[model samples]
Target: MKKLFIFTAILCFSHANNEMEALYLQNGCNGCHGMYGEGMGASPRLQGVREEVLLRRLKDLQKGKTRSAFGTIMVSFAKALDQNQTIEMAKYLSNLETKVDDERYEIEYTPAGDGGS
Candidate 1:
Protein backbone atom coordinates (compact mmCIF):
# COMPACT_ATOMS: atom_id res chain seq x y z
CA MET A 1 0.00 0.00 0.00
CA LYS A 2 2.78 2.39 0.96
CA LYS A 3 4.70 1.71 -2.25
CA LEU A 4 1.55 2.15 -4.27
CA PHE A 5 0.83 5.46 -2.63
CA ILE A 6 4.34 6.72 -3.31
CA PHE A 7 4.16 5.64 -6.92
CA THR A 8 0.80 7.28 -7.35
CA ALA A 9 2.06 10.53 -5.87
CA ILE A 10 5.07 10.55 -8.18
CA LEU A 11 2.90 9.86 -11.19
CA CYS A 12 0.54 12.64 -10.28
CA PHE A 13 3.41 15.10 -9.93
CA SER A 14 4.84 14.12 -13.30
CA HIS A 15 1.45 14.47 -14.93
CA ALA A 16 0.98 17.91 -13.47
CA ASN A 17 4.40 18.97 -14.71
CA ASN A 18 3.60 17.79 -18.22
CA GLU A 19 0.26 19.56 -18.12
CA MET A 20 1.90 22.85 -17.17
CA GLU A 21 4.41 22.56 -20.02
CA ALA A 22 1.65 21.87 -22.50
CA LEU A 23 -0.36 24.78 -21.15
CA TYR A 24 2.62 27.10 -21.57
CA LEU A 25 3.17 26.06 -25.17
CA GLN A 26 -0.49 25.90 -26.17
CA ASN A 27 -1.45 29.29 -24.76
CA GLY A 28 1.74 31.05 -25.85
CA CYS A 29 1.86 32.30 -22.28
CA ASN A 30 5.62 32.17 -22.27
CA GLY A 31 5.83 34.91 -24.87
CA CYS A 32 4.77 37.42 -22.26
CA HIS A 33 4.82 35.48 -18.95
CA GLY A 34 8.41 34.35 -19.64
CA MET A 35 9.86 30.92 -20.41
CA TYR A 36 10.23 30.32 -16.68
CA GLY A 37 7.31 32.48 -15.58
CA GLU A 38 9.74 35.24 -14.64
CA GLY A 39 7.77 37.49 -16.99
CA MET A 40 8.77 39.97 -19.70
CA GLY A 41 7.95 43.36 -21.19
CA ALA A 42 4.94 44.79 -19.37
CA SER A 43 4.03 41.43 -17.81
CA PRO A 44 4.60 40.76 -14.15
CA ARG A 45 6.96 38.05 -12.89
CA LEU A 46 5.01 35.01 -11.71
CA GLN A 47 7.80 33.23 -9.87
CA GLY A 48 7.78 32.90 -6.08
CA VAL A 49 4.24 34.15 -5.77
CA ARG A 50 2.13 32.16 -3.32
CA GLU A 51 -0.20 29.63 -4.89
CA GLU A 52 -3.23 31.13 -3.17
CA VAL A 53 -2.42 34.56 -4.54
CA LEU A 54 -1.75 33.13 -7.97
CA LEU A 55 -5.09 31.35 -8.06
CA ARG A 56 -6.96 34.40 -6.83
CA ARG A 57 -5.36 36.64 -9.41
CA LEU A 58 -5.96 34.09 -12.15
CA LYS A 59 -9.60 33.75 -11.15
CA ASP A 60 -9.97 37.49 -11.01
CA LEU A 61 -8.46 37.90 -14.47
CA GLN A 62 -10.56 35.10 -15.89
CA LYS A 63 -13.71 36.63 -14.45
CA GLY A 64 -12.65 40.08 -15.69
CA LYS A 65 -12.56 41.06 -12.05
CA THR A 66 -9.27 42.81 -12.70
CA ARG A 67 -7.41 44.52 -15.52
CA SER A 68 -3.82 45.18 -16.40
CA ALA A 69 -1.75 48.10 -17.56
CA PHE A 70 -1.65 46.42 -20.96
CA GLY A 71 -5.34 46.78 -21.52
CA THR A 72 -7.28 43.49 -21.50
CA ILE A 73 -4.36 41.24 -22.27
CA MET A 74 -4.37 39.34 -18.97
CA VAL A 75 -8.14 39.12 -18.84
CA SER A 76 -8.22 37.46 -22.21
CA PHE A 77 -5.15 35.36 -21.62
CA ALA A 78 -6.43 34.00 -18.32
CA LYS A 79 -9.82 33.17 -19.75
CA ALA A 80 -8.33 30.21 -21.62
CA LEU A 81 -6.95 28.64 -18.43
CA ASP A 82 -8.94 26.32 -16.20
CA GLN A 83 -8.54 26.02 -12.44
CA ASN A 84 -6.34 22.90 -12.47
CA GLN A 85 -4.17 24.23 -15.28
CA THR A 86 -3.70 27.50 -13.46
CA ILE A 87 -2.65 25.68 -10.28
CA GLU A 88 -0.21 23.52 -12.20
CA MET A 89 1.28 26.57 -13.91
CA ALA A 90 1.68 28.30 -10.60
CA LYS A 91 3.38 25.24 -9.07
CA TYR A 92 5.81 24.91 -11.97
CA LEU A 93 6.74 28.61 -11.91
CA SER A 94 6.98 28.90 -8.16
CA ASN A 95 9.39 25.97 -7.96
CA LEU A 96 11.90 27.67 -10.25
CA GLU A 97 14.78 29.65 -8.74
CA THR A 98 15.09 33.08 -10.35
CA LYS A 99 18.34 34.98 -10.83
CA VAL A 100 18.91 38.47 -9.44
CA ASP A 101 18.94 39.94 -12.93
CA ASP A 102 15.81 38.03 -13.77
CA GLU A 103 14.02 40.02 -11.08
CA ARG A 104 13.61 43.01 -13.40
CA TYR A 105 9.85 42.63 -13.59
CA GLU A 106 7.93 44.35 -10.83
CA ILE A 107 5.03 42.66 -9.08
CA GLU A 108 3.57 45.87 -7.70
CA TYR A 109 0.83 46.86 -10.09
CA THR A 110 -0.96 50.19 -9.94
CA PRO A 111 -4.63 49.82 -10.81
CA ALA A 112 -5.80 52.00 -13.68
CA GLY A 113 -8.18 54.00 -11.53
CA ASP A 114 -5.46 54.97 -9.11
CA GLY A 115 -4.47 58.49 -10.08
CA GLY A 116 -0.73 59.12 -10.03
CA SER A 117 -1.43 62.52 -8.59
Candidate 2:
Protein backbone atom coordinates (compact mmCIF):
# COMPACT_ATOMS: atom_id res chain seq x y z
CA MET A 1 0.00 0.00 0.00
CA LYS A 2 2.82 2.38 0.88
CA LYS A 3 4.56 1.62 -2.39
CA LEU A 4 1.37 2.22 -4.30
CA PHE A 5 0.89 5.55 -2.63
CA ILE A 6 4.46 6.54 -3.41
CA PHE A 7 3.98 5.59 -7.04
CA THR A 8 0.82 7.61 -7.25
CA ALA A 9 2.53 10.66 -5.75
CA ILE A 10 5.38 10.35 -8.22
CA LEU A 11 2.98 10.07 -11.10
CA CYS A 12 1.11 13.18 -10.08
CA PHE A 13 4.32 15.17 -9.67
CA SER A 14 5.57 14.10 -13.07
CA HIS A 15 2.25 14.95 -14.61
CA ALA A 16 2.42 18.44 -13.11
CA ASN A 17 5.89 18.94 -14.51
CA ASN A 18 4.73 17.85 -17.92
CA GLU A 19 1.82 20.26 -17.74
CA MET A 20 4.12 23.11 -16.79
CA GLU A 21 6.44 22.33 -19.67
CA ALA A 22 3.51 22.27 -22.03
CA LEU A 23 2.32 25.60 -20.74
CA TYR A 24 5.76 27.09 -21.24
CA LEU A 25 5.92 25.83 -24.79
CA GLN A 26 2.38 26.90 -25.64
CA ASN A 27 3.21 30.41 -24.44
CA GLY A 28 6.11 30.62 -26.94
CA CYS A 29 8.72 30.81 -24.19
CA ASN A 30 10.65 28.07 -25.96
CA GLY A 31 11.41 30.48 -28.77
CA CYS A 32 13.65 32.50 -26.45
CA HIS A 33 14.36 30.35 -23.45
CA GLY A 34 15.56 26.96 -24.62
CA MET A 35 13.39 23.86 -24.36
CA TYR A 36 14.98 23.09 -21.01
CA GLY A 37 14.70 26.66 -19.78
CA GLU A 38 18.41 26.97 -20.51
CA GLY A 39 17.88 30.29 -22.25
CA MET A 40 18.98 31.52 -25.69
CA GLY A 41 20.63 34.56 -27.23
CA ALA A 42 19.29 37.34 -25.05
CA SER A 43 16.93 35.40 -22.80
CA PRO A 44 18.01 35.01 -19.20
CA ARG A 45 18.42 31.50 -17.89
CA LEU A 46 15.27 30.40 -16.06
CA GLN A 47 16.25 26.97 -14.89
CA GLY A 48 17.65 26.80 -11.36
CA VAL A 49 16.56 30.31 -10.58
CA ARG A 50 15.19 30.52 -7.01
CA GLU A 51 11.44 30.00 -6.90
CA GLU A 52 10.73 32.98 -4.69
CA VAL A 53 12.95 35.18 -6.81
CA LEU A 54 11.48 33.93 -10.05
CA LEU A 55 7.93 34.38 -8.78
CA ARG A 56 8.67 37.90 -7.66
CA ARG A 57 10.27 38.77 -10.96
CA LEU A 58 7.41 37.33 -12.96
CA LYS A 59 4.91 39.20 -10.84
CA ASP A 60 6.83 42.39 -11.37
CA LEU A 61 6.92 41.82 -15.08
CA GLN A 62 3.21 41.16 -15.10
CA LYS A 63 2.70 44.42 -13.26
CA GLY A 64 4.99 46.36 -15.60
CA LYS A 65 7.25 47.20 -12.70
CA THR A 66 10.46 45.70 -14.02
CA ARG A 67 13.20 48.20 -14.76
CA SER A 68 14.70 46.65 -17.88
CA ALA A 69 13.34 47.34 -21.31
CA PHE A 70 13.66 43.64 -22.18
CA GLY A 71 11.16 43.07 -19.41
CA THR A 72 8.58 44.88 -21.49
CA ILE A 73 8.33 41.91 -23.76
CA MET A 74 8.30 39.63 -20.76
CA VAL A 75 5.34 41.59 -19.36
CA SER A 76 3.31 40.88 -22.45
CA PHE A 77 3.92 37.18 -22.01
CA ALA A 78 3.58 37.13 -18.26
CA LYS A 79 0.28 38.94 -18.41
CA ALA A 80 -1.26 36.06 -20.27
CA LEU A 81 -0.75 33.72 -17.32
CA ASP A 82 -3.00 33.66 -14.32
CA GLN A 83 -1.42 33.87 -10.86
CA ASN A 84 -1.55 30.15 -10.35
CA GLN A 85 0.04 29.36 -13.70
CA THR A 86 2.78 31.87 -13.03
CA ILE A 87 3.50 30.28 -9.66
CA GLU A 88 3.56 26.83 -11.22
CA MET A 89 5.96 27.98 -13.90
CA ALA A 90 8.27 29.52 -11.32
CA LYS A 91 8.31 26.34 -9.30
CA TYR A 92 8.84 24.11 -12.31
CA LEU A 93 11.65 26.24 -13.75
CA SER A 94 13.39 26.71 -10.40
CA ASN A 95 13.63 22.96 -9.94
CA LEU A 96 14.91 22.22 -13.44
CA GLU A 97 18.36 20.68 -13.71
CA THR A 98 20.78 23.20 -15.21
CA LYS A 99 24.32 22.60 -16.41
CA VAL A 100 27.28 24.89 -17.03
CA ASP A 101 25.46 26.63 -19.87
CA ASP A 102 23.34 28.30 -17.21
CA GLU A 103 24.79 31.76 -17.52
CA ARG A 104 23.05 35.11 -17.61
CA TYR A 105 22.04 35.86 -21.19
CA GLU A 106 22.47 39.47 -22.18
CA ILE A 107 21.96 41.37 -25.37
CA GLU A 108 24.71 43.68 -26.53
CA TYR A 109 23.79 47.21 -27.36
CA THR A 110 24.15 48.78 -30.81
CA PRO A 111 23.55 52.50 -31.14
CA ALA A 112 20.55 53.34 -33.26
CA GLY A 113 20.60 55.67 -36.27
CA ASP A 114 23.98 54.28 -37.09
CA GLY A 115 25.12 54.67 -40.67
CA GLY A 116 27.63 51.98 -39.76
CA SER A 117 25.11 49.38 -40.84
Candidate 3:
Protein backbone atom coordinates (compact mmCIF):
# COMPACT_ATOMS: atom_id res chain seq x y z
CA MET A 1 0.00 0.00 0.00
CA LYS A 2 2.84 2.38 0.78
CA LYS A 3 4.53 1.57 -2.52
CA LEU A 4 1.29 2.07 -4.37
CA PHE A 5 0.79 5.48 -2.81
CA ILE A 6 4.31 6.53 -3.74
CA PHE A 7 3.78 5.42 -7.31
CA THR A 8 0.52 7.29 -7.51
CA ALA A 9 2.14 10.44 -6.23
CA ILE A 10 4.91 10.20 -8.79
CA LEU A 11 2.40 9.66 -11.56
CA CYS A 12 0.43 12.72 -10.57
CA PHE A 13 3.57 14.81 -10.37
CA SER A 14 4.61 13.69 -13.83
CA HIS A 15 1.24 14.54 -15.32
CA ALA A 16 1.35 17.98 -13.76
CA ASN A 17 4.87 18.53 -15.08
CA ASN A 18 3.81 17.59 -18.60
CA GLU A 19 1.00 20.11 -18.47
CA MET A 20 3.43 22.80 -17.37
CA GLU A 21 5.81 21.97 -20.21
CA ALA A 22 2.95 22.30 -22.64
CA LEU A 23 2.21 25.71 -21.19
CA TYR A 24 5.83 26.71 -21.72
CA LEU A 25 5.70 25.65 -25.35
CA GLN A 26 2.33 27.27 -25.89
CA ASN A 27 3.78 30.54 -24.64
CA GLY A 28 6.59 30.29 -27.24
CA CYS A 29 9.19 30.03 -24.47
CA ASN A 30 10.78 27.08 -26.24
CA GLY A 31 11.94 29.43 -28.96
CA CYS A 32 14.44 31.04 -26.60
CA HIS A 33 14.46 28.97 -23.42
CA GLY A 34 14.88 25.75 -25.44
CA MET A 35 12.71 22.64 -25.31
CA TYR A 36 13.58 22.19 -21.63
CA GLY A 37 14.22 25.72 -20.35
CA GLU A 38 17.94 25.05 -20.81
CA GLY A 39 18.15 28.16 -22.90
CA MET A 40 19.67 28.82 -26.33
CA GLY A 41 21.84 31.45 -27.96
CA ALA A 42 21.65 34.71 -26.07
CA SER A 43 18.90 33.49 -23.79
CA PRO A 44 19.95 32.69 -20.24
CA ARG A 45 19.37 29.26 -18.78
CA LEU A 46 16.77 28.78 -16.03
CA GLN A 47 16.89 25.54 -14.08
CA GLY A 48 17.43 24.17 -10.60
CA VAL A 49 16.25 27.37 -8.97
CA ARG A 50 13.84 27.68 -6.06
CA GLU A 51 10.16 28.20 -6.99
CA GLU A 52 9.77 31.11 -4.59
CA VAL A 53 12.94 32.65 -5.97
CA LEU A 54 11.63 32.41 -9.51
CA LEU A 55 8.26 33.81 -8.52
CA ARG A 56 9.98 36.83 -7.02
CA ARG A 57 12.19 37.20 -10.07
CA LEU A 58 9.27 37.01 -12.47
CA LYS A 59 7.39 39.62 -10.53
CA ASP A 60 10.46 41.80 -10.57
CA LEU A 61 10.85 41.37 -14.31
CA GLN A 62 7.24 42.29 -14.78
CA LYS A 63 8.07 45.55 -13.07
CA GLY A 64 11.02 46.18 -15.43
CA LYS A 65 13.79 44.91 -13.16
CA THR A 66 15.31 42.61 -15.72
CA ARG A 67 19.06 41.95 -15.69
CA SER A 68 19.62 40.77 -19.23
CA ALA A 69 20.23 42.10 -22.68
CA PHE A 70 16.81 40.86 -23.66
CA GLY A 71 15.15 42.35 -20.59
CA THR A 72 13.13 44.78 -22.63
CA ILE A 73 11.81 42.00 -24.83
CA MET A 74 11.23 39.63 -21.94
CA VAL A 75 9.28 42.26 -20.01
CA SER A 76 6.32 41.88 -22.33
CA PHE A 77 6.54 38.10 -22.26
CA ALA A 78 6.72 38.05 -18.48
CA LYS A 79 3.72 40.31 -18.23
CA ALA A 80 1.80 38.03 -20.56
CA LEU A 81 1.54 35.55 -17.73
CA ASP A 82 -0.81 36.08 -14.81
CA GLN A 83 0.20 35.20 -11.24
CA ASN A 84 -1.14 31.64 -11.38
CA GLN A 85 0.65 30.84 -14.61
CA THR A 86 3.78 32.34 -13.17
CA ILE A 87 3.56 30.09 -10.15
CA GLU A 88 3.03 26.97 -12.26
CA MET A 89 5.90 27.75 -14.57
CA ALA A 90 8.20 28.60 -11.69
CA LYS A 91 7.33 25.35 -9.93
CA TYR A 92 8.05 23.27 -12.99
CA LEU A 93 11.30 25.03 -13.72
CA SER A 94 12.59 24.89 -10.16
CA ASN A 95 12.52 21.08 -10.22
CA LEU A 96 14.73 20.62 -13.26
CA GLU A 97 18.42 19.72 -12.85
CA THR A 98 20.47 21.03 -15.72
CA LYS A 99 23.90 20.04 -17.02
CA VAL A 100 24.78 23.71 -16.80
CA ASP A 101 24.95 25.15 -13.32
CA ASP A 102 23.26 28.40 -14.43
CA GLU A 103 25.49 30.54 -12.29
CA ARG A 104 25.22 34.31 -12.39
CA TYR A 105 26.18 37.33 -10.35
CA GLU A 106 23.37 38.68 -8.26
CA ILE A 107 21.76 42.00 -9.07
CA GLU A 108 19.55 43.93 -6.70
CA TYR A 109 16.23 45.29 -7.86
CA THR A 110 14.55 48.26 -6.21
CA PRO A 111 10.79 48.80 -6.30
CA ALA A 112 11.18 52.32 -7.57
CA GLY A 113 10.41 50.91 -11.03
CA ASP A 114 13.48 52.45 -12.61
CA GLY A 115 14.42 49.17 -14.35
CA GLY A 116 17.16 48.61 -11.83
CA SER A 117 18.95 45.25 -11.99
For this target, which candidate reaches the highest TM-score against the unseen true structure? Answer: 2
Q: Which one wins by lDDT: 2 or 3?
A: 2
The list of candidate 1 runs beyond 4 A from truth reads 97-117
* TM-score, per-candidate, Cα-based: 0.72, 0.75, 0.67
> Residue pairs in steric clash, candidate 2?
none
RMSD of 2: 10.4
Which pairs, if any, clash in model 3? none
Worst ten in a row by lDDT for model 2: 102-111
Instruction: List, residue by residue over 1-47, the lDDT tens digit for candidate 3.
Output: 99999999999888887667666656678678765678777776777
Winner of 1 and 3 under lDDT: 3
Q: Write the per-residue lDDT of candidate 1 for residues 65-90, one digit (tens) a residue.
A: 86566837788888887777777777
Q: What is the clash count of model 1? A: 0
Clashing pairs in 1: none
Candidate 1, position 85, lDDT: 76
- Please list the C-alpha lDDT of all candidates, in the order they appear: 0.70, 0.78, 0.73
Model number with the top lDDT: 2
The C-alpha stretches of model 2 lying farther than 4 A from their native spots are 98-117
